[model samples]
Each structure stands twice: as structure tokens, then as C-alpha cells.
Target: MARVLIVDDDKNIREFIRLVLEEEGYATVESTDGRDALRKIKEHPCDIAVVDVMMPYMDGISLTKEIRDIYNIPIIILTARGQIEDKELAYTAGTDDYLVKPFEAKELIFRIKALLRRYGTGEEEAPVRLGNVLLYQQNYSIKIGSKTVKLPLKEFELLYLLGKNPERVFTREQLIEDIWGLDFEGDNRTVDVHIKRLRERFRQLSVPARIHTVRGVGYSLEVDE
Candidate 1:
């Protein structure tokens, strides 16, 4: 499930949003104001933040700018005003989307899902970038600088899965189900062999990206640089 942070000073509004979001199977963290939201975001690292304007401290636009400076998570600015000026300010502050007050539950859920897909958060597939490595599905290849290599079918799919959700561990069983068919019989060794091949390929590309093993758990992709 995707995680969301809801920031609002009104207890009723916060609870309402939390209920709606939880009903849709989303994990939510609630905050009373911008400062609290910032703390929650830093500690918990949510996938998206739904912020209310005109709060006690920092305000929504300011909080958006601050979050943009640090984390790359998507932000949705919520406000009571319908003024274009407020929308422009929110967008200028780096909010990915904007929603007015009294929004319908379905609209809010739709916007959240759209933003998640656009940002490649959770399990959604999209083109991913880490340092100089670019994985694009349009061309079905990995592009490093001017050289683009179309990997073999399995290799490409495996690399794409790892790249799609960077820093998120996927156990061997999860990887097998995601990349290969669930009916395909495979052991942990299969994932190991594919990971080995990906490592060698990236080593040849000379990029900052690397796949890390989580001992007895699984594997995650990390970029150092």
C-alpha cells in the first residue's frame, strides 16, 4: 500500500481525510500543521503529502517549497480558496497537484493515484533514472550516455523491476512473481544469477547505481554519488 501524509489544523477534516484514505487501503499519517507535517515526513518518509493551506506555522506553499528542497515525494496543496493566484503560488512552490476544500473522496483518490503513477511511486511502472542510468520502456532499453543497449527479455524485465522501485527491498519470492510467472518454478538462486548479470552490466556501464543484497531478506537498488 502507498503511504500518504495529511496535514491540516482542523481535527474533523484530518479525520475525514484519514477515513477516506484508509478506506481506499492507503496508509496515512496525520499532522496538525506544517511543522508537524515536516517532522512526520522526515521520520516516516511518505509517498505523498496532502497539505492544507492557512495553517498555524509555515503554511502549505512554504511547506511545499521546503519538502521540494529535500525529498522528491509528490505533494498536493489543499486550500479553501479557488483563486488562481493561490493555485499559481502553490504550483510555483513545487506542489505536484492542487485540490480545493470540500473535495469529493473519489476525486481526491483519483488525483493521488495519478500523481503516484506520474512519480513512479509504489509498484507502478515508468521510466526510471539513477545518476547516468536511464531505463525507458518506450524503447525497451537502458541508455547510458549515448550508448543504448536492449537487454535480453528476462534481463531487461528484471532490471526494470529493480529500477522501478529503488531502495525498496523485494524478496526472492516477490521477485520471481514479479519478473517470472508465478507458475514458474524457481529458487533463490535464480534471482541471484540475474542480479549477478545486472551487476556486471552496470559495472561495464561505469555508473553510480548498484544492487545490494539484504542478507537473508532480499535485494534493493541504491545509487551512491
Candidate 2:
């Protein structure tokens, strides 16, 4: 059974999610505030998280950013706001999916299952290997050749997506939409900077694969042969 964390200021919403998740055979933990949610996550590692976009003390976006900094757990952002800008912001903060307010419980459950599947959390495997890099995706750590490099949330996620698809191209827009959440307000340059940093880390350790730039398109990882 997957363990899930529910973070939302609204009592009813949290309870609703908890009940639905429990029905799906998932164990759940709840927090009504972002600060408390962060603490709870540390004390109890969860397979996934469902967070509200707005909250007192630390807002969902900030919490998502902070959590991504330390963990690779999948996250779904639940919000009343349905603007494109809001979705963009959530994406920039590293949310895997965005759910608008007044959403159906069944839809939420479906999204969670899809994300879990995409992340491969249902598998009972060891580290995932890409060329000379061994990615401990569940833990958000990477082993490049002889050196183990700890990645911040954003970088780890960026690399993970590219590594998962190998040579498939991902446009900046696609990346921002998929990984950052739906409400990200960042520019395309942000993607470039992160990629540059990722490349540098791989280069420093002489990793066998490179994150290749597909000019006029997006980026991808290519195993050098």
C-alpha cells in the first residue's frame, strides 16, 4: 500500500482526500498547514503528496520547492485557482500534477495513480542506471561514475525526466508544464540554467551520457557511443 500525505488548510478538503485515498488502500497523513506538513514529511516518508496551493505560514508552492529540495516524492497540487499562470507556478515549484478546485474524488485518485505509475513507485527495484550514472530516484540521489552527487529537487527531477525518455525531445514549455506544476511563472532561461548545471555536474565526473540541446526544439539525454 502507498503512503500519502495530505496538506491543505481546509479541513474538509483534507478529510475528503484522506477518505478517498484510504478507500484506494493507501495510508494517509494530514497537515492543515504547510509548515506542519514539511515536518510531518520528514518524520514519515510518503510515496506521494497532495497539497493545496494556498495556505498560511508557507504556501503550497514554497512547501513544494522545499520538499523537492530534499525528496523525490511525487506531488499533486490541489487549488481553487484554475488560471494558466497558477498552473505554471505550480509546475515551476515541482508539482507533478495540478488539480483545480471542485475536482471529483475519482479524478484525483486517477491522477495520483497515473503519477505513481510514471514515477515507477509501484516497482520493487534497485537504483535505475543510465550509462555510467546510477539514479536512486526514490531517494533523489545520483551516482556518477565513482562520485555520488546529491541533487536539489529541481535538478534531480529535470535529469530524471530526460533520463527516462533518453533521446526523446522535451520542449521548455513541455518541461515547465510537466515537472514544475501548472502555475510556474519562470522563463525558458531557467531551464537552460538548470540544464547547464546538470551538464557541468555530469562532466565533472566524466559521466558517459550528456544532456543534449536540440536547437530550435528542447533538450534530451544522449548516451555517447
Candidate 3:
């Protein structure tokens, strides 16, 4: 499991982010401020760091610069500031990504996965096998028995994420961020539409894996036994 360092002065926010990351299988370390966060990172390096802006001892932008100067770890700034100038400052400070306050839990997870993949640090996701069907990550193609079929980009990535985790359930909100992105203005029904199309395509190809909906919750990929 990847380790994530969470830096925030607000205990509730820290805990909330921690819960979200922990639920997604990431180990978390928490700090109350940027000064403390720096010390923690030096003592226990993490794969990624989620820093909050407007903290006491040291602000997130300053911390981001310090971290960049010494470590190659990816950084994501979580703040209530949505101003363009604030975002520009974060990018200038070497932040890999930024998330505004009141963000979706799924969006956070999606960004972390994206950053890991972008930096080539999270390559542990394996190809999915379901009876006669195979979901290839590298080529972004699906194989059904002897035939190889290429799916649309979003569909392929969505299917791969679900298939890679097998029985793990993913909420519609999670799907939206993982596929449409956090900036997407669409509703959750968009996920349903994609899943419907994915199912239809799988049916046409006679693929054995099916996406199962968890009522009022999310969806999961189920492989036939």
C-alpha cells in the first residue's frame, strides 16, 4: 500500500482526508501544520503528500517549495482558495495538483491515482482476467477469446479500474472523477450511461465479466466463477 502524508491544521479535515485515502488502501500520516509536516516527511518519507493552504507555522505553498527542493514526492494542495491566482501560485511552488475545498472524496482518490500513474510510481495495477476476456492496460485493448477489441478511451479506463480491483465497489461519484474528471459539470447519471454502454459492448463481444450495481451505493466488476 502507498503511504500518503496529510498536512492540515484542521483536525476534522485531516481526519476526513485520512478516511478517504485509507478507504482506498493508502496508509496515512497526519500533521497539524506545515512546519510539523516537513519534519514528518524527513523522518518518514511518503509516496505523496496532501497539503492544506492557510495553515499556521508554514503555508502549503511554502511547504510545497521546500518539499520540491529536497524530495521528488508528488504533492497535492487542498485548499478553500479557488482563485486563479492562488492556483497559479500553487503550480509555481511545484504542486503536482490542486483541489479546492468541499471537494469530492472520489475526486481526491482519482487525482491521487492519476498523479501516481503520471509519475510512474503506482504501476501495481494488473491486467484483468475474466474467463475468456482480458483487459490489457498497456495497449488499452480488450480481448475476448481470440478477438481483440479496442474500447473508447473513457470506457476502457473505467473498465480497467473496476476490473483491476475486482470485487471492490466504486461509487458513481468516484467513476465520474476517474473518468470525466473533477472539473466535469455533469451529473452522476453520466456514469450510468457509460456503464450501460460498457455492458452493451461487452454483450456484443460475449465478454464474461459483468459490472454489478450496488443499490444506492456504487458498482463492482464481477467475474464469472
Candidate 4:
């Protein structure tokens, strides 16, 4: 059973979420503010976090940013503000999803399940061998011949998605939606920047896997044998 942490200022809301999650066979933890939530997360990480944007001690956006700095745990932000700008802010702060207030419990549960399904678990058949590159998904790291290179969270995610389906092309827009959560809205150049950084790191380590640009389409990871 997955364990979920619910962070909100309202006692009623917390109890409601706790009961629902418990019914779904998930263990629940509750925090009334972001500071407490952060401490709890550091002490013991949960499978998912549902955070309210309007907390008393520390706001959800700041908390989300802090969490992103250290952990890759999935987070969903809850807010009364239904504006696109608010959603975008949540995304920029590293929320995995966003839900406006007055949402149905069923909808929240569905979103939680969907995120877990998309990111949860699967074992690789074998060590992914692409030319001189060896990607060990089990341990979440990579090697190029003799030297091992560690990837940051976002880079690893992007590379893994591309490498998993080698030949398939994905546009920047698709990537942003798929990887960075649906609410992410920044310049498309952000994708280009990350790609350039990824390519540079691989090159520095002499890795053979290449990120191919499909003009007008997007990028694909191609293993050159």
C-alpha cells in the first residue's frame, strides 16, 4: 500500500482526504502547514504528497520548491485559485499535478492514481546498452565505457523517456506536457536548453547515445552502433 501525505490548513479537508485515502488502501499522514510537511518528508518520504497552496506557516509554492531541490516524490498542489497563472506557478515550483478547490474526492483520487501509474514501477529487461553507453535504470545512473556519470532528476527523466522509445519522435510541447506535468508553461527554449546541457554532459563523458533533432518535430535519442 502506498503512503500519502496530506498538507492543508483546514482540519475538515485533511480529515476528508485521510478517510478517502485510507479507504483506497493507502496509509495517510497529515500536516497543517508546509513547514511541518517539509520536516515530515525529510524524516520519512511518502509515495505522494497533496499540498494546499494557502497554508499558514509556509506557502505551498515555497514548500514545493524546497522539496524539488532534494526529492523526486510526486506532489499535487491544491488551490482555490483556478487561474492558469496560478497553475503555472505550481508547475514551475515542481508540482506533478494541480487541482482547484471544490473538486470531487473521486477526481483527486483519479489524478493521484494516474500519476503513480505513469511514474511508479517497472524493471528493465537488461542493462540498456547503446554503443559505448550503458544505462542502469535499476540503480538510476549511467556509464560511458569506464567513467560513470550521474544525472540530475529532470535530465534522467527526459533521457529515460527518450531512450525507452528510441526511434519515436517527441516535440518540445509533448515533452513539456508529458514530463514536466501538464501545467508547465515556459518558453520552448527551455527544452532546447536542457537538451543542449544533456548533450554536452554526454559528450564530455564520450557517451555514444545521441539526441537527434527531427526538424520541425522535436528530439529523439538514437543509439549509434
lDDT of 3 at 138: 55
Q: Per-residue alpha-carbon lDDT of model 1 for 82-136, expressed as tens digits?
A: 8999999999999988888877776688678767866878554466887887887
Highest lDDT: give the candidate number.
3
TM value for model 4:
0.54
Cα lDDT tens digits, model 3, 1-225, are: 789999999999999999998888898999999899989988888999999989997999999999999989899999898999999999999999999999989888988987877676765556688787888765678887678988887888898888888899999988887788879898999889889999998788877889999999999998878
Model with the higher lDDT, candidate 1 or 4: 1
Q: How would the candidate models be sorted by TM-score, starting from the highest?
A: 3, 1, 2, 4
Q: Can you give the lDDT of residue 50 in candidate 4?
A: 95
Better of 2 and 4 by TM-score: 2
In order, candidate lDDTs are 0.85, 0.85, 0.88, 0.82
RMSD of each: 13.9, 9.4, 4.6, 8.5
Clashes of 4: 0
What local lDDT does model 2 show for residue 38?
A: 85
Candidate 3: global Cα-lDDT? 0.88
Candidate 4, residues 1-225, lDDT tens digits: the string is 677889999999999999998998788889999899988877777888899999898999998998888877788999999998999999999999999888778767767866665566322336677676777655557887677777876676678778878889999988876666554668678889889999998778777789999999899998877
Clashing pairs in 4: none
Lowest lDDT 10-mer window, candidate 4? Answer: 117-126
